[model samples]
Target: MSVDLETVKRVARLARIAVTTEDAERMTGELNAILGFVEQLDEVDVSGVDPMTSVIPMVMRKRQDAVTDGNKAADIVANAPAAEENFFLVPKVIE
Candidate 1:
């Protein structure tokens, strides 16, 4: 895919960047070179490759799933500036 001067100008406008005529010409060449490299990558064969989360393999650490604060509602409400009926109260904003 080749990038033209008009395409470079359009891209610069869309990105909110101010580019001179000379800068646009330089950018057009650079963008075409980048697209050519991407086209080369499209020809590589990866049909047998599996998607990877990381290049190195390691086991994630596990922890117990039991709840440790199932009955601490009163303790948590005590720290609130204004709590009522086990809920935090805030100033009403709308009628």
Candidate 2:
């Protein structure tokens, strides 16, 4: 698809960018060039190519989904003025 001068000006206005008529005219050509390049990319044969997240071949590191209470409860409450059973005992605030 090709971009026209009006489309460029409309897009600029929608994006809240102030563009003069000359700039819009210039951007219309530039946007058309970019779209033409993207269209050319669609013509390439890439059915054999596999999509990947990284360039380097590596195994994804994974950990076990084991559930645990994360034994740091006692350590976290160590600095509290009053803590019992790995819990902080706070004074009642509501009347």
Candidate 3:
């Protein structure tokens, strides 16, 4: 895939990057090189390869999903500057 100067400029605009004409020209070549490398990688044969999250094999540690602080609503509401009925009260903004 060939990246043109206009495409690079458009990408810079979309990314909110302040790019000069020289920088855009340089980026055009660099982006084209990266896309060409990806195209080359797409040509590689991986018919029987399994998808993996990481190169090293490891298992994730599991934890119990029991609640540790379920009955602390009064303690939590005590710290609030403006709380009522175990709930924090805020000024209504919407009409």
Q: Which candidate number has the best TM-score?
A: 3
Off by over 4 Å in 2: 61-95
Model 1 lDDT per residue over 2-50, tens place:
9899999999999999999999999998999999999999999989998
Comparing 1 and 3 by lDDT, which wins? 1
Native-referenced Cα lDDT, model 2: 0.93
lDDT value, residue 86 of candidate 3: 88
- What candidate 1 gets wrong by more than 4 Å, as runs, is 59-95
Candidate achieving higher TM-score, 2 or 3? 3
Scored against the true structure, residue 5 in model 1 reaches a CA lDDT of 99
Using lDDT as the yardstick, the better of models 2 and 3 is: 2
Rank candidates, TM-score, best first. 3, 2, 1
48-78 in candidate 3: lDDT tens per residue?
A: 9987767997776789888775798999999
Clashing pairs in 1: none
The regions of model 3 sitting more than 4 angstroms off are 62-95
Question: TM-scores, in order shown?
Answer: 0.61, 0.63, 0.65
